[model samples]
Target chain A: MRVDYRPRRVSSAIAVLAAAGSVAALATVSEQYLAVGISLAGVLVLAFGAAVYRRGLRVLGVPIALVGVAVGFAGFGVGVSLVGVYDRSFTYTGELIGLLGLPFIALGVLPVHRRLSRRLVSLGFAFLVLGVVFTGAVNGTGPDPIPLLLGIVAAIVAWDAGEQAINLGDQLGSDARTWPAELSHSGGTAVFGGLSVGTGLVMFNADITGLPLESLLLLLGAALVLMVALYK
Target chain B: MSNATADTTTKARATNTDAATDADAATDAEVETATSSSYGQRVSTDADGDDLVVEGERRRTGRWRGIVAVALFASAVGVLANTPFLLLATVPVAAYAAYPRLTGSPSATLAVERVIDDDTPDRGDDVEVTVRITNTGRWPLTDVRFVDGVPPMLAVREGSPRHATFLWPGTTTEFSYTVGAEYGRHQFDPVTALLRDVSGGTELEAEVDCDPATVLTCTDAVPEVPLRKQTRHSTGRLVTDDGGAGIEFHRTREYQKGDPMSRIDWKRYAKTGQLTTVEFREERAATIVLLVDARPSAYRASAEGEPHGLAYNLAGAEQLLTALGETRDYVGLAAIGREFCWLAAGVGLEHELTARELLATHPVLSTVPPDEDPTDPDEQAAELRKRLSGDAQVVLLSPLGDEYITSLALSLEASGHPVTVVSPDVTSDATVGSRLAGVDRENRISSLRQAEIPVVDWTVDEPLGTTIVNSTEVMD
Candidate 1:
């Protein structure tokens, strides 16, 4: 089957999402010092994504996208500060927004069809979610569990759908017979996503405080078996 | 009565002119008398006009929409959740999406022009080509990148064909490059241009039609060629065959009725009571047909950075044509390609010109040689045999890289036509495959020589003229 591999676009899309999630999480942080470090990481991720997407420009694309993103963040930050409404959250968010440039830079420089880039993108999003959850816990006034769960579910679905779309487009580009393959692939991904969301909801609601160690071990074994079955 | 007839013809001609004048008077009086003559001249020359073919169009490659949409969604979510950080992501995406929309389509107003230093260069001459791109629209083009479509036959000698620049309205940007001319008629391809906005989101790709009239016609001059010593019975520069009325003495014979008085031996008459006649060998011209193997397999070069075998064959053919022309012999040309190409044997200025033009521009003699022959070897040979004169000799020019060429030569020799192979060596010992090919080629040449067909195994490193001369000396 013909497959048109476009790793750059897919990686860039994931990076954009991760940077956005990082900015949203950093906006609520009270400690300015911690926000600065997190914001810089977000900016780096955005720059990497920008670089990856503009790979045709070669080494030149990396610097162009990174510098453009940095300049954009600085300009926005300065404009907001002039308006007298700049705060620790706004500064941190601006810095995190700078992270959107990472994808552009990554897209420009990274080679296509690399599994590592995809894995890194997924990990980046995971880190963003964990950071948000950690911030909420430290504040002692966390977001509602249901909305946060829905958001996470939405994020996962978007990411999976984007990946599938890229794959489908690539197959079509290569003139491959994609209808049957795409249909089954999409169905499988949807089922996995639904099961994960359902399990997360169940775990959140279930009262495990009084459960015995033996029973907990039994639940862990059952979960492992379910995961294996799902994998196959 | 003859005077009356002449007067009658003159009157009729005058009346015809008057009739033409009456017809002209019926039309607009402003029409000049020279118009009719000029129109006739134009109609005669219009048969060979240049053709302009435009290919490719501007199309949008939507690469950035998905990312923009995802960024927008994230920003909306951030606004709803009172998170300023998510809104920051919307800034870059919005700018990227809006940037392309700000600049309307520039392809409609873009004009490309190609200029070459020499359109009709000799073979091996370097030609400089300059491509100019101008924006005719009112809006300035923020980013532009273009790659010139250089002909495949020619290789770039200096500079690159690709360039990137930004142009303002009514401004022009150009890039120049040089390419080495090869033997063929090369038509320039259209230049491909890609224009993008400041945000690098949307791209408009277009194939710009440049100078369609720009063409390079590279021709080789005839070089000194060497031929074999063997000659047939015909009137030519080669002295051959039995005794006749010629310079060198053959034998004395008894005087016959048709014997001229000058040929009678007066010394023999004084010595004995007998009349003898003197005879000399007759000199006859060779009828030769130069055959070039343009098959796909014969298109290989000796190494990575060398010209292909077909180029060498053409040079050899040109040389042979010159040699045969000097001898005032009947010479023709044939190329074995997808289709069998033949030029009839003749002797004249027009014939030489036609042969040279065919060698330089025939579709069978493409710069980027074809890989396979459409017709089988047997069919091609039959076609070649049909066009060949009965006693005409064949000089086969090939790389001998493939076995089929050897078979073709042997078959022609077997068919009563004396065949001489002038094979250009296009194999090297640098690599194993090349080494094997070189050995195989050597075997083919040796086998042909064993069959008594004169084979000139010309090496690529040696000059063609020197090789031909050495081979002829060896044959002698």
Candidate 2:
């Protein structure tokens, strides 16, 4: 049997994305009964994508991953329309959605294809958003947006950390001497994760009383600073 | 007249000494200075000077940018939806964006000291290398990652040469690793050091210079090689063609006036009723030259981690030389490469040492093979013919990986030197190319054997002694 062992970056990225996609789909399905079909389809597509990617059929794997994303969005729309029948509390629904993305977060972090893994992470976050937003829209009382936003932030951080870890693993695979540099880089990224969680908690409690125009101007300034800081 | 001659000799000796001193100074200067380039950076300095410093540009990976954009989008959505919770999502994004300000840029004042347990090691010996990195700058480095550049050819035997740690001002950290030495001069690759901020947003990569290189010499003291059935016209252990006064009897000849009493052949004389003398087959020393094929084509290995065919041929040549030397036969050394290397045939302790040094340290048989062939086949063969004595036999050590080698062997045989090939098999059946190469090699070996040249097909899996014994038995 021909094993499709791709470059370290490609394989790790693919694995991460597939895992994240699975988690996102599971989260959406648990929020609404109507979303079960879409979740199943997303899961099926991602699983196939992983299989084909491992088989060295990258051309087929990517398309399958994309199809899963489409299925996930379709499921979100269907779940929103049928959310009235399910009378679960917003907190329970929100917690389940948050918990559902965990498996995908774990999977997304696996060393696979870097690009595909990133895409899977985005898809997973999309599924979480879809579930929370639809449940809120149908219930006429949206879930606590703070917790939902926190979950999205956590997913993004996980994806970033996973990417760094996979990249380090690739470096280590090529040369053991690269471990020091890779480990240091990984440690630096880990600090970001802690900072992100801390900032989220602080922002959840802080009250910002300012004029709308002033707030918009402040946000624009912050965006410009962020762009400048992150510019390569 | 004696005084004048002595004065002239003294003046000449003084001038020669001055020239010798000047030459030694030039060579010392060259040895003291070394320069190397890695990762697009060039470093040049005296060997005893402070280590060369290479600095890289600070670059951002743009990871936090995506989160920042998402935060901005969420804020906009929050304003429209009148949800404060949506706006709160931007907190982590803004914090990550500003995290770089908490840490300073990586310091350039980093020193690397590399120490090896053995600078000159024997082949296959493990050498332990310790690299100590010190932070000389005032700022405390939050995250410093370094990988000691080990040569690609050497295999790490134990431990790791990489480390990730935090170093304060005037602090030092070290990592140690062991690598198995192979025959050749191996230069350590520059140590790659990467400095990052606490947020991992910015990176500064640099290559640090350490020690120059390590040299490994493979030595052969005694090698037991099986001899072929056919022996040349030589007075040695091998029985030869002509009859002379020796232990092995040839025939009974008519007794001459000067015949020795011990060789009178009394049993033959008693039976024939006539005086007779015993004659034995003549045994004389044979002049043999061992030629190792160090051509670019012969530098191939069957597997990635295995030594190339040239290495095997070198070892085989050493064994043959040792075996031949034991029998008190005149043995010489020659290499077929870009440049022809030849040593005159002689027998003695001094000559053996010279042969071993030539085989081990000759530039032609370097660890890494040269890219281009400097000498053509005709020129190489002509040089070999010119160097070899009229009665000297040739022992050609080659992989027969290419057609040119077969032709070269044939040319040597045609030039009146009896050629015995001890080809080290370096082809495998792993891939399609390798399988085809194996077939090509087999064909070449068969063609050489068909041309009346005695070929010892040596497989790497078997010992040289065993292979030579089997080939000799087959020839007999």
Per-candidate local distance difference test: 0.56, 0.61
Which candidate has the top score in lDDT? 2
Candidate 2, lDDT over the whole model = 0.61
lDDT by residue (B77-123, candidate 1, tens digit) is 54345443223223333333333344455543466667788878986
DockQ of 1: 0.03
Q: Which stretches of candidate 2 lie over 4 Å from their true place?
A: A1-179, A188-232, B1-239, B243-282, B342-346, B361-363, B369-382
Q: What is the interface RMSD of candidate 2, in Å?
A: 5.9
lDDT of 2 by residue, B98-215 (tens): 6666556775567766777876787678888878777877887766777777654467777766666678888888879888865444446567787776556677888776433323
Single out the weakest 10-residue window by summed lDDT for candidate 1 chain B. B42-51
Minimal lDDT window, size 10, model 1 chain A: A171-180
DockQ numbers for every candidate?
A: 0.03, 0.19
The segments of candidate 1 whose C-alpha lies over 4 angstroms from its true place after superposition are A1-232, B1-50, B54-157, B160-224, B228-234, B245-254, B262-274, B371-373
